[model samples]
Target: MTETHATNPPGAPVFPPGRYGRRREPGRRRPLVPVVLAVLLLAALGLGAVRLYTQYGDPAYDAQVITYTDITDSQVVIDFRVTVPAGGSAVCLLRARSSDSAEVGHEEVTVTARPGERQVTARHRLATSERPFIGEVLRCRAPA
Candidate 1:
């Protein structure tokens, strides 16, 4: 006759085991959809930024001084041509400068192009404070 003690038998296994339980389900993996969407979103934002910079960073209208005359002691007449998008009104800033490049006069003139015409010719007479040695267009733009 034999008695079994609290301790395991010498030949008995210390613990019963087969496969350990997983910390998480192996079939349930990290989703890849969110990562792909994040990348696509970033790419789209970058393209939009590039497009905006290219569109607004540069001047849109083209201008040239066709001719100028009637340069009096305190006045000047300027004739210029502007090429811009049709159907929109544009504002042209004119400046009269002395031989030393000092501003003697300034004027903001507005012009409206025909519905299908992008080029327009204009002649304007501006008042000045002194005799202007040079009169030209400072800048032109479509009102926002």
Candidate 2:
């Protein structure tokens, strides 16, 4: 067996200044690549989310007013078009508005088509309570 000796000198501290009694500092700086990559990844995901919504998440039906005529004191005629999904039905709210923005007439029109037909066009004659300035299809939706 080798001879054993006391590890620390009697008049000196058990450890040196840099061991545990001094402030700790980083030896080498951490690389910035990981943080930058994380930020870029988050940005890419956010952009993808927005793109997905705009591309595939929008409401599909859009109603277009083709013509409106015969605006009498008690009636209005409107022609409009709407698109529908296969085997789907839509209820459109038709309205006639006066010059002062008062709603003079209102009705719900149901539109449907064969499974392969993607669109439907219709003419509506709304009976109004007073003279109206415009006839419009306010909104259309799929029925439950």
Which ranges of candidate 2 are over 4 A from the true structure? 1-16, 19-59
| Counted clashes in each candidate structure | 0, 0
C-alpha TM-score for every candidate: 0.63, 0.63
Which candidate leads the pack in lDDT? Answer: 2
Question: Deviation in angstroms for 30 in model 2?
Answer: 7.1
C-alpha-based local distance difference test score of model 2: 0.84
Indicate the TM-score of model 2. 0.63
Tens digit of lDDT per residue, candidate 2, span 1-144?
A: 332337544664344444466543437888799999999999999999999998877457768899999989999999999988765678899999999999999999998866888788889899999999999999998765
Candidate 1 stretches greater than 4 Å from native: 1-43, 50-59
> Which residue pairs overlap in candidate 1's backbone?
none
